[model samples]
Target: MGMITWNCTEVEEFILLGLTRRPGMQIVLFVIFLISYVISLKGNVLIIFISRISPRLHTPMYFFLSNLSFLDIWYTSSIVPKMLINLLSFKKSISFHGCFTQLFIHLCLGGSECYLLLAMAYDRYVAICSPLHYTTIMHSSLCIKMASGCWIGGLINSLIHTLFALRLSFCGPNVINHFFCEVPSVLELSCTDASLNKTIIFFCAMLVVMGPFFLIIITYGYIINSILKINTSVGRKKAFSTCASHITVVTLFYGTIIFMYMRPGDIHVANQDKMATLFYSVVTPMLNPLIYTLRNKEVKGVLLEITRKRHVP
Candidate 1:
């Protein structure tokens, strides 16, 4: 066991061995990451614009969609900008507090995203399965409440876990394997008995991560069942189409997540960890607006009409 010490004077910053050390790959990584950042920003902002323009889309569903887009924008923006700079620059060090702040906000947004996905699934299920009460159950105030819950719950959860992680002592091996400061990566640096940290983190995960995931699955299960029961072919198609985009986004986000951090870090390939982290953190957030907003007819219609009207006068 690495000897534990709490000498704040001992450490000021930590080195991060990012995605790759190969200087040859720097330019290639910069180009690809730059494109991703651009697309992500455009896609999410477009969603927000469309949601605001379309009167017909001012319902609970679109309200949540708008929030989701906002979250995606900030979520990716939190990591990708700094990471892109690190990829191009020789300096790849992060201040100890900055690292903790990044981890805190990252986990908070990630947790909220998980719940937002589930909330969306629930919205779909109610619209399809219990159409009569859809309005009552998903009222404007209720929608706001649910969205608030996602953000507030995520903030509290992030605070709890990050506090525990922060208390642990870091020793000699100050370099993190991944690009950013994740819970597990930071815990690995601790020079103390990490079992307590691990246990607390595990509990936090059950409540914050795994719990929402299971709820999403249950909601989708009902959604699928309700779709299958529709009598006419067109009815089923309509029901499925309403959800296809959200479902696709959910699968992409959650699939990568479960595959990445659900299991113990030991069995997985160490080098691939950064790649998996990239998928959920960068790739998924960038693609979310595309999957949920761009292909959505209402969103697209609103966007087109807004742009045309702006030039009309």
Candidate 2:
């Protein structure tokens, strides 16, 4: 069923050396991460609900956004709750199967988010650059296809990396120097030579992370150019407003990912990686809903109407 050698010395579990080691800080960290997890779930779920029920948001952009919110839920849910429990309890160990499951889910959702954002950038490009053809180019069928492609692309990417990781053997000193079972952290504990794994990770990082990032940058380039051509100040401001939230989210999301993964495997600083993961995993998901709701006037109006309607009856 698989290419990996399963008989290599059995590693039953892994100890996660969470964000901090100071005994006093564990409680503090627990509270903080617990609150973050709660907010992340609430915010992303509300975004999905509002995006679905608001007829005003029944467009390509909101469709992509709802997908994004859904991914965010899976993304944060994969790691944060376990992390919270670890912080509170003395048992910081996770079963070998559980670790890999977390790895697959996080990577699948994270990679999906990357491609989903790419789709969003293209949506903006079409809406702004070729307004007349927007509806025709990004029809219902096409949107579904693009979104489906993102999820499938992510699944394939995760599957490749997961299999690659499984091929290596993890032996003693089975302590991962982070809050969760990330690829790099787990790979550090491998007893066998992992040069191939490192190389593949670097290539995948470039292809999945940088590849979409550059695409997003190029798309925004055309979008900005199109906005500049508008004669009126109001027109330019409105156009800028449309894509501004996306740019902000992109910067926040990619800034952490690029920093975390685009490095020589040996040079990774554990504490720094933990903090970066924290931002991307917890903070970014929570902020996405806030960013879209607060910054976008249309969503805010819809949210208000929803609130008002509930009170009216």
Best by lDDT: 2
TM-score of each: 0.93, 0.97
Q: What are the Cα lDDT values of the candidates?
A: 0.83, 0.91
Model 2 residue runs over 4 Å out of place are 1-7
Candidate 2: worst 10 consecutive residues by lDDT?
Answer: 1-10
Query: Please, what are the lDDT tens digits per residue for candidate 1 over residues 1-313?
Result: 5643333425567778888899889778878999999999998898787788778998888899898999989888888888888888898988888889999999899889888888888899899999999999998888889999999988988887787776677755788888888777777777776777667666777777788889988888998999999999999998898899988988888887777667764455657777878898999878888787656787767777777998997
lDDT of 2 at 186: 88
Candidate 2 collision pairs? none
